[model samples]
Target chain A: MSDDKAGASPAAAYLAIDWGTTNRRVYVMAADGSVLATARDDRGIKSVEAGCWADELAGIRARFGDLPAIAAGMVGSTRGWREIPYVIAPAGVTELATGIGRIPEERFFIVPGVAYDTPDHADVMRGEEVQAVGACLSGLAPHDALFCQPGTHNKWIGLKDARITSVTTALTGELFALLRDHSILAEMMTGPVEDGPAFRAGIADAAGGDLLSRLFGVRASVLLGRRAREDGAAYTSGLLIGADVAAREVAGRLVHILSDPNLGPLYAVAIEAFGGTSTAIDGQAAFVAGIHHIWSMIDD
Target chain B: MSDDKAGASPAAAYLAIDWGTTNRRVYVMAADGSVLATARDDRGIKSVEAGCWADELAGIRARFGDLPAIAAGMVGSTRGWREIPYVIAPAGVTELATGIGRIPEERFFIVPGVAYDTPDHADVMRGEEVQAVGACLSGLAPHDALFCQPGTHNKWIGLKDARITSVTTALTGELFALLRDHSILAEMMTGPVEDGPAFRAGIADAAGGDLLSRLFGVRASVLLGRRAREDGAAYTSGLLIGADVAAREVAGRLVHILSDPNLGPLYAVAIEAFGGTSTAIDGQAAFVAGIHHIWSMIDD
Candidate 1:
């Protein structure tokens, strides 16, 4: 069921919409694998009401001209425009292409999400699967590699022979946001996070374990005049990212990170601090390449 | 500075207010260390404006016959009725009584909280110092023991020879509440948390480490149809508590828990599951005994 034979390539251009929960990125790709124009907006899948998906698609088509389209991410989840069932791991381009579902009476298709389930543990990802597979296709990473995709829910994906074998998602960004916006820790964190001494110190402390207790130290240290209040947010970021990296067997490994300009370096430093080497590959480029590869393989 | 000598006991009846951020517990105590009457209200220190503390005290005294009052918890902090400076640990009743700061032109006194500061770590507690000390005085725990006071911010205190030597606080309850009420995980958590198999399974997963990833698994497991939606909250509770317990040297140790009827047993099971023994001491009783002990030693 996962391995459908590749069909003949289409000669026309298509719209690749990476529709996420809060933001949508649209890429107008030519048949020759060049991006003609790209646009991003806050009109993510979550913004559209259930009966308004067609209107939303029509609006996108109104801007870019109606061409065939391939949408991914939350747009295909249960809460999105159409719910596409997840393709189980070990899955790759063929598995994903075969699992793609079509929108009724429209020339629109959705790339299915990926699920990693065992007898004891389970994990899933929607948009990130495209980026991971695309990273491999674009030669940014090897077919057998480890990729760290940092976001609200940071994913640690294990790829084997061009197929995604496992994924571990960490609630680092979301947890940080919650603590910064709503918890008592918010009052102490007035400054922006940077990869500096305070952050590195937090990474060092994370090596000792006990994250919950260490998290409170951010407030307690400031309250007791033992640490500067300005260093609070950075320390928190370090603690969270450090803990995420420390959980893995990264002591002697080369981790390929799907890089965000700001968050990528932090993870790289954290990984290096924890005795791992890393190379950051541009996340957007990988997603584009992934969607393009999938598009090339889709039946005309 | 923490070694003030005990003063002669006062003869008049007084008020013992265990005043925290969100709730206040008042005990009308007799001269002989017995509670005459008790009342609880949501008029915590946070509820009263800074300048209006005098009027708030007036309101309480107006109802309780203008008696002298000793308030603990946030009432002593900067945001409370008055900003009583923290007493450095290892501090006991004599130290707390000596460090007590009085409300200007009033018969009310606020017990100074304790601060455990070192070169690399710092921690402080307002009311829990009293509870931990009181637990020892009330014979619920030995002088040298480990005490876990669970709540929004759960404190892990190390007592040495009846004095608080160390403190480590975890944002377990607050984190749990934030996830349940705000995060994507909230939708999956419709049922109450219990100490059941689902929770134990979470504890087992926690033992494998990588907490941020394990936390995300709560949502993933449910989404993949591998776990029941009803068990989401319990699994989350277990993961958090288990991670907390695992962070400590709880193996073969007896942890003295200041019990909250609902949350106490969960910590107990987590401790025992992680190879530790535990005994639950009534938190309210400890507070009463602690305030009584401090009151008995205060100078008239």
Candidate 2:
């Protein structure tokens, strides 16, 4: 049986492109903000030459129908097609929509990222802002809550009254990858990382403080015949994730996590391990919902 | 004026080899533990083909006169000539001399590294142990005080009554190099790092906790135009060093820093910044003194 609407298909709306450095995901949305079709490819912003953004967009449009396009993420960074200024937090969808930059052709629009700036501290994010705003708009996250977005750069963002208030980013994923590939502990960590005893034990170890010391312990423990070599990766992962969680004030509070299938559950488990409750929201869904909300506000 | 003694050259005693993964430093010492000659080369344990250690030693003997050799560091590791078990902490020159492993030739001896193992935690070190012991034996360090040995694997050692009481290792230098060479923060960290405002600021930031987040801030601050790109490396260095120092209990005590000229003052500064006074001891001097002390006990 066809699962499509019983009547004619809904009219095609704008094409949403989550254009990142090495990959791009495009979603076709109907006028009612429902996704009609979606596709992903490796031809991200980095693959497109500076002057070939027009051709790139045309190719994407040709495959998904000639619809106006709205892109987010690195597509708006300095290295992307055109630089888009970042809107400062305490911002929500309304501010983000206003800060959106458009190409001269007027057919493609790029969303601005968000920045948290202080005299002594500053942080910036491009693609994750859209997903965060979407989570708030979709009611998946409360107006005043903490959201954990885990990735190469894990972001712990705060929202107040439906607007992003603060942003704290951790280099957990990047550091983990760097250590796995290039560190002295690399050889021992060539094993699968799962949520098991070793991982939980690592989380427990993180509470003891001194991450750099703990990192070396990964190698030391194995060398001492106290820990299996295979569990090094999982334990290190737990230690990093645990440190990321423990650094926050998450005692007796709920955290909303926006992530993919792989990192979402892990982050949720880490939050629970650190005495906090969390709910995982699909990242792609949040991005699409966020874009749709912005579309409705602007397309009209 | 001749710098050497006017009499006949002192009889060749033992050749102390600080053997490591990529480089080796050898010192020819007199019976009194005074260095008669010193040289360094790249024929480290890694470069020597397996099962060719005898030939490798022969080559070294060919360069210097055939003398009994005492080796330390990775030379005694599993991948080296022969694996030597590590001695437990609360050890001193006496324990190290007793735990020394010897080759079949009887002319070659390897100093065992030190290990701090508890039911909940474990830490190990190779060449640094010899240096720490030397610092104590040479009267460069107090018997009951903290010692910070900074290097690729920074070690914080505690000594009580001329014996090693505790050991904690941090991957500060290794992680700094890894991030500077590979992480996203690499681009901005191309400039030279020195003792400056940026470095001190990084050390100060480390006191706030959440090192992973602070690491990301190294990049975020630059991207947000709040920090100069050139200062990124120094700032990051300060952060890692600061974190390493803060993790220890050095509020009001004196820390003896065993390090080279480059890292010695830096660690001293970091320790002072973290509310501790510190004294810097020459690393090579400490190593030679340590080996000499051990040799005096063993050769007798």
Candidate 3:
């Protein structure tokens, strides 16, 4: 059904918002947690004027008639519409839902991200916590599992008994993009995102040695005419993902990869090359499912 | 002595040219290997128009007469004035000199870079091979040693029997520049290029884990208020260098770091932090000495 028609229905339930730095997605769900309609726009938290989050929520309410809304992602960041304190790990949906911060007068609340503190370092994640929660609730994740959410910041998370115990962020995708666009290696790469032999070769190359030294091979191989120029992108992708997987030492473990469509296959291939098995989950569906799960946990 | 005065001297020995991608330096040397005068400009190989190598050499000849000139670095690459095929390692000054490509009638020749081949990978170095030869001839490098020439591409060379046996290129410096100027971490950094505790901390952080994950800590630490934004550059440098050192497993060994003044101290510090000792050699002096050494080996 159309969003307006769903909004007009007496059965219209709750509004779920996945609000990140670059895009905003809203889902209309019935009381039973099934999505009825969805809407999205480029008005991410970064583009919204400061102190205007309330007004922005008001506009959304105007269309959906004041349905109670729950938001996730960077919308709760310092640079976002509001700054919500992080819920420390090992934390589950209950802790995350309980940490939600409400707008002063609106029927809107923001989901708090999860943070982990090790003896040597600390890490924090915003929207991915929602995805983790969704994965657990949707039964895609096991009681004890390793989850990899690959994107600009690829996160490898350790979950136990539905609680996120650890989080590690890899700058794989960002580094790949940076090198592809700016590094000397950029001159050699051809398009259509290479995937077969060149990519597997990259993964194999990443199996040993320090990544700092290995990265230069991308340029060196092409310059030496040892590898085809068209294979540059795949080689780079394999190198990054391979290094990441190797560092994690995920051998023999089943890794659940939650990634956008484009990156899912690459991570899966790399994981297998590194002696691990992985299953890919749709990121957007997991994101929406996560929001719905968290929204259901919040008390009126 | 002034360049013109030295050019007029009958005692003028030979010419040494260190031509890289961004800058070019020419040295007039006495027969005894002392530098009589030096000149430099931004007219590196990259700036020189195609087929203009002869014109460029002629302009220098007009100023310095018919003194035989030996050039090294990017000037011999495909993009340079002439393409000199790489001399395979285990190679030394004599081998490099023998591979020098001459310009038809001009008293000028280009030094060939050294290349290393492994069953799995290939690597090549141009100007630094000259410095490696210089380091050996100058007695700064041991018969068997690990040499690090730090710059855009940091080369870790294994020298034995006065020959470069192995070559590993680390893109540490280039990666640092990319992140410092373009990544999200750039917004948080204020620099005088940090060199103290933060740098050491970054090195320590790199001791374990993949670089892809460790790099993200630079941003997360700042956002979490654990580190000052100003320390970002040092932290990044430490992370890259530390990862490089740790990966090489160079503990307890003496590393000869041939670097420009600015990068020398930083590397020395990182090496010490990682349980190794290092000696910093001036890169430019080494370059000129390398050119002279190779030139002396060329037959009349």
**Backbone clash tally for model 2?**
1
Q: Count the clashes in each prediction.
A: 0, 1, 0
What value does DockQ give for candidate 3? 0.77
lDDT of 2 by residue, B159-204 (tens): 8888898999999999999999999999989988889999999999
lDDT per residue (tens digit) for residues A1-300 in model 2? 122222223477778899998999888888888888787789988799989888888888777877788989999998999999999998999998899888747499899999999876688889888888888888877778788888889998898877889999999999999999999999988988889999999999998878999999999999999999999999999999999999997889999888667778877878898899998877888898899988777742
Quote each prediction's TM-score.
Answer: 0.94, 0.95, 0.95
Q: Best candidate, DockQ-wise?
A: 2
CA lDDT of A225 in candidate 2? 91
lDDT of 1 by residue, B61-109 (tens): 7666568899999998888877899999888888998998886478888
Q: List the residue pairs that clash in candidate 1.
A: none
Model 1, A1-300: lDDT tens per residue?
111111112433888889999999887777877777777899987789989988888888777757889988999999998899999999999899999988747789999999999875689999899999999988989999999988899999999987899988999999999989988899877788989999998899888778988998898999888789999999999999999999987999999999888899999999999999999888888999898888888884
Per-residue C-alpha lDDT of model 3 across residues A95-197, encoded as one tens digit per residue:
9888998884677789998887776767889999888768877787776878898888899888898788998888888898899888987876554465699
Which runs of model 3 end up more than 4 angstroms from their true locations?
Answer: A1-5, A62-65, B1-5
| Chain B TM-score for the candidates in order | 0.94, 0.94, 0.94
Cα error, residue B63 of model 1, in Å, equals 2.1
Per-residue accuracy of model 3 over B1-300 as CA lDDT, tens digit each: 455457767778888888899998888888877788888889888899997778888888778766888888899999998899999999988899889888857777899988887777688898888887787777767667888887888889888877889999999889988897888778765665757998988888888756787788788788778888888888888888888888776789999998768777888888888789999776667777777888787874
i-RMS, each model, one decimal:
0.9, 0.7, 1.3
For candidate 1, give the lDDT of residue B55: 90
